[model samples]
Target: MRRIEKNSLGAALMMALLCSCSGRTTSEPFVQSVSLTRPIALNRETSHLYSGIVKAAHEVSLGFKTAGQIARIHVSEGDYVQQGQLLAELDDADYQLAVDALQIQYDQLKDEVERTKQLFNQKSVSANDFEKASAGLRQLGVQLQANRNKLDYTKLYAPTNGYIQTVNFSPAEMVDAGTALFTLLDVSRLEVEVSIPANEYLRRDQFTGFTCRAAGLKNGVQLRLGSITPKADGNQLYHLTLAFAGQPDRRLTAGMNVEVGITVADTTRTGGFGVPPGAVFLDGEVPCVWVFGADSTIERRPVALREMDNEGRVVVIDGLTGGERIVRAGVSALEEGEKVRVVETPSQTNAGGLL
Candidate 1:
């Protein structure tokens, strides 16, 4: 009976040993399907940001110099006019009649003065009589000149070349002296006025490379800084003036709201690897990137990021060395030290080429 017991114990021991070996050998590798790329080096990435519209520089208001009843309106709102061009005509009939009357009186006074002078020269009239005739001529001439000016004022002319924005008085409307006849905008040159907060002005050099964009500019257009106003606004906003690179099309007009972006600085670093924005996942507050090893093993490494560019790529600032294989796609489904099959997509190949 003792011999039988020993044989049973030996069999049990052999079975247990085989089971342990099988357990160790049958365990599968943690296979994770992913895409990978080398980590980019610094000095190979650029930073980009966005901002709002800047208006053109020069603007003026056109007002009537003299008061009169509007007889005709020569131009309407949005009409372009040249300097000294007639903008409107008042009730010039009365003014013309007054001028005509003054001309007639002046002519008569001149004739009388000429006759008086002749008489005085021939001793047919006293010096006092000749002086009276001369004085009458001078007084009439002054009055006639005043009347002529009133007539000329009846016509409204543009002070400068610009687009007419507002026409306050319509035909037959009584406009008073110095009334606003038109609001002209000089769009020949436009200025983009932006108010940068005090904090932004601290880096005064950042204002150098900004671009201004309106509704239609998707590709982005460049803007040049015209001036930085020294004084702040009521809210302590520093006003910045940016001039357009070239004359914008007529479609761009004054008072049109736009988006502007000031280039803070050139942060294009070299040898830095970029990944699709989707691939960047946060492990707590720390930025962590996944890299695939040569044997399809995944390793999670911390990375420093500088800024995101306009192209939707995140810049790998540091904590990553160049030419290190990193998981480019399917980063969200990765675990530390997991075995991954690096599936090279067309985009992934292109990204590899870029580095």
Candidate 2:
């Protein structure tokens, strides 16, 4: 019975040794695979593109200076008019009759004033009598001139070169004085409008140049800064206006859509760097990136961000110098000081690393 018990114990020991070997084989540490990229070096000059719209430099509402019935309208909506060109006319029969009556009275008053002056020279009239006659003649002359001006005001003329956008009244319609008769879009000059964020608004002084691209424009049109609104809108965006540096294309008109490009000069002594946004993660409210070291390990590094560019790359103002390889994929699952294997991009001919 003692010999049988010894054999059973040996069998139990062999089974325990096999289980321990299996455990040892499956206890290896996990090494994560990740992709890496190098941060791009930024230059002192950076360019950004934004959607903008073309607008007329001035929108003018043309109206008559005197109240009258519109006799005729010479121009229609969408018609191009030039400065001093007659656009509309009012019924001027009443104004003309008033001017004729004033002229007749002025002529009679002039004759009386001349005779009184002659009498004063001959000492046949008192000084007060001569003065009264001269004053009456001057008052009548002023009245005649005012009536003539009113007659001229019966016609509406284009104050500037522009295209008529709207005709508010029809022929023979009675319009009050200073009532808008035509809406003119002044195209003598063109402007481009764009909305920018507060960050760009604060750095507006750093903008060095501006250009715009539109449909059918092979080359971009240069622009000059015109004005910026002091207050921000509900979207927290400031309205910026830019005028053409020179004369714009003849085909370009108001209400056309365009893309504006702005070039800004970097004022920082240490230039900024560009990195993919995914590589940057938040660490306790601080922006951080996983920088891969020569030892095949990652170190969490804090960085100062300025703003994202049009290409969606974050501009790093501090913490990274440039040309540093960083983990670009699966950054959230990474831990500090952990060893990782870099994932190599497969060549086009050897896709999936099948070879």
lDDT of 1 by residue, 274-320 (tens): 66676678898988888767776778888888677545678886777
lDDT of 2 by residue, 240-337 (tens): 99999999999889999999999888654245788888999999999999999999999999999977765678889899878789988789999999
Which predicted model would earn the best lDDT? 2
> In every candidate, how many clashes are there?
24, 0
TM-scores, one per candidate = 0.59, 0.69
- Model 1: lDDT to the true structure: 0.75
Q: In angstroms, how far off is 68's CA in candidate 1?
A: 1.9
Error of 2 at 299 (Å): 20
Pairs with backbone N, CA or C atoms under 3 Å apart (clashes), candidate 2:
none
Model 2 / residue 27 / CA error / Å: 27
Which runs of model 2 end up more than 4 angstroms from their true locations? 1-41, 268-355
